[model samples]
Target: MLSTPISLPTVFVGAAIIFLFALALYPSSLLRWFQRKRYQYEVTFSLYMLTPTEKFIFNSILFLFLAMVSIAVALYLPRHVRIIAHRAYYYVSGDLVKNGTTSAVLGTTAEILTPTTVAEAIGSA
Candidate 1:
């Protein structure tokens, strides 16, 4: 059986379909997100009426949020990328596993999906 390489747009559409299916299964989650966004938009984030202390407090909270995000990206982003690349490499370029023998794509997906692999990935970063 010849396997055609999936195009980028096709992959994106498939992903979107899967995402929509998930949302369909748990629609309240999506609705809650929309509701949260609506509520969030109701609040005006301005430093205009703030006293010096309030401004400092607001800036501190903003800085902390940004710092945490930066730290998470610095720490986890590389590991996440490495895991995906590692899995893709194994998937695209090795001996193929026989079917009914696996729930994973090549039996390798399950092999690489271990917590050990994830931990190893995290440790390398």
Candidate 2:
């Protein structure tokens, strides 16, 4: 009989890793696509509710949650590895945010104002 080089576990592990990587990179693309699809014609709102720091924190939290759940499911259901991998990828990369343009504007504004604050006046002015 011919020798089988790759085992099922190895394949599953590789798929899981790829899924996680995709998830990590999905946020920005997914968010942008979602906004374009759903609110393409609508007037954009302000990002007054969340700062860039808050946005990053929120995205990180979401990514962590997805990673945890994906890992848990993958560990518990080895046979359904493919399904778990797909779900994890989708969840991780899926767009959870709606208005990215507003956030961009807010971030830009913050950047612009940050250097003009009174704290910088002592040295520059």
Candidate 3:
């Protein structure tokens, strides 16, 4: 059976229909968001009283939150990447053996002796 790809206009029409249906069902929700009043919070420091604008506080919070998240990712991502890469290396080794290609050299060595046994043997010597 031949499959036909949906066109761009078809997707737009479907989206429009869904949007109109949602608008019909809950028109107030959209209006509530658009017509909502901005909330302001005052921060009092010892030197100065600052009443930051809603947008400024929101932007600052967003920026600081994202910055912290980025820093955390930078600190932790390498460990995860190294673990995944190590697993992938072993998986590729097994695949190479199955495919009758040159088996990974490290994989052959690992098969001869488990890592802990090899470490203990080496340490005893």
Top candidate, metric lDDT: 1
Off by over 4 Å in 1: 1-44, 94-125
Better of 1 and 3 by TM-score: 1
Tens digits of per-residue lDDT, candidate 2, 1-125, equal 74978889999999999988987777678778886764543333333356878767866897799999999887877746655665566477542122233224333333333334433543553
Q: Local error of candidate 2 at 62, Å?
A: 0.8
- Tens-digit lDDT track of model 3 for 15-112: 99999898877868657665443222222222124344655676688779999999999999987787666667757663433321223432343234
lDDT of 2 at 29: 81
Off by over 4 Å in 3: 1-52, 94-111, 114-125
The whole-model lDDT of each prediction reads 0.66, 0.59, 0.60
Better of 1 and 3 by lDDT: 1
Best by TM-score: 1
TM-score of 2: 0.28
Q: How well does candidate 2 score on lDDT at residue 8?
A: 92
List clashing residue pairs in candidate 3: none
Give candidate 3's whole-model lDDT. 0.60
Candidates arranged by TM-score, highest first: 1, 3, 2
Cα TM-score of candidate 1: 0.39
Poorest lDDT segment (10 consecutive residues) of candidate 3: 38-47
lDDT of 1: 0.66
